[model samples]
Target: MLAEADNGAELAASMAELKAYLRIESDGEDAVLAGLLRSAAALCEQFVGQWLIRRGARETVPADGRWHRLAARPVVAIGAVAAVDDAGAVTPLPVEAYAIDIDASGDGWVRAVRPGNRLAVEYQAGMATDLNGVAEPLRQGIMRLAAEHFVARGDEGAAPPAVVSALWRPWRRMRLS
Candidate 1:
């Protein structure tokens, strides 16, 4: 459970709703939510540094409302998400408000929103950079860092800080109201 707001009170209330809302049915306990979880991990791994650190629930609340909670019930070995900036700074990441989850077989898709904002990175490149043209493996690598770096390589100070997806969100500004 995680939520974002300029004020702590609003975020707390939202977290409560988040926790209650994420329960899975017995059948849902199976593989119903696996792909979405994978995509969430990829999103986290792809936006490291720019989005900073994993999310945190309001201290006033009794539960931990980090974005990783989504993976918690699913028994995902790897969990957590943070967006870092170009300067390599770490700050609390936003909760995942919503995302697109699709069936690989193209059967269907669903839109899901969690409690808080997802880590949004900020990076820039030259005209020839063509970031959109990056290969899928590199994209997955970026997603890997966004999801797993903090626990394994980034903050824990592994021999070599793990590879993270660092980028600038120039066109996309925070819709903070």
Candidate 2:
């Protein structure tokens, strides 16, 4: 199973930024705004197909001597790679036993020196290591989207404005089906 290990402390759009965007001056709606910001960040990630905040993740895959692509983009580092047995036991592989490669587009790839049935790889990936590192357009999109969500609170079915997509389009990863 692959799962995110950490989401980091900084949000793509901070509460203060969102509040300022919405012209909200009171703290009464802080909790609601926080949720909206998180939701907006998540939506941005989904649209871009990348993590906006740096975080760790683990994924298990068949180690068949073929390059296996990591799930997250713009991988920052590979922490560990281990072989997993049918009994669910994990044995860490030596650094020399595998190779890690990241493409120009920031996609990470891994392959074992020797073929094995399965392996688990732990790594970090994201578009930015911190909130400030995120692109301006992405941050702005998050703020705008959250503000839109706040204003349209009861209209969950409404589509996000085209500007959100426009702002995020450049960062969107294109996957060939």
Worst 10 residues of 2 by lDDT: 5-14
lDDT of 2 at 62: 85
lDDT, candidates in the order shown: 0.29, 0.86
Over 1-177, each residue of candidate 1 has an lDDT whose tens digit, in order, gives: 323222222122222222234443344432323332334333532332112122322211112224221211111122233433446454544445323222232111112244422333221111112223333444344334323432352345443224432332221122223
Regions of candidate 1 where Cα sits further than 4 Å from its true position: 1-138, 141-155, 158-165, 168-173
Provide the TM-score for each candidate, comma-separated: 0.18, 0.94
**How do the residues 1-177 of candidate 2 rate in per-residue lDDT, one tens digit apiece?**
779954535763388888888988999999899888888888899899999998889999888899989988878888899998889899999999888888888888999889988889999999887667899999889889989989988986988889999999999996775
Top model by lDDT, which number? 2
Least accurate 10 contiguous residues by lDDT in model 1: 69-78
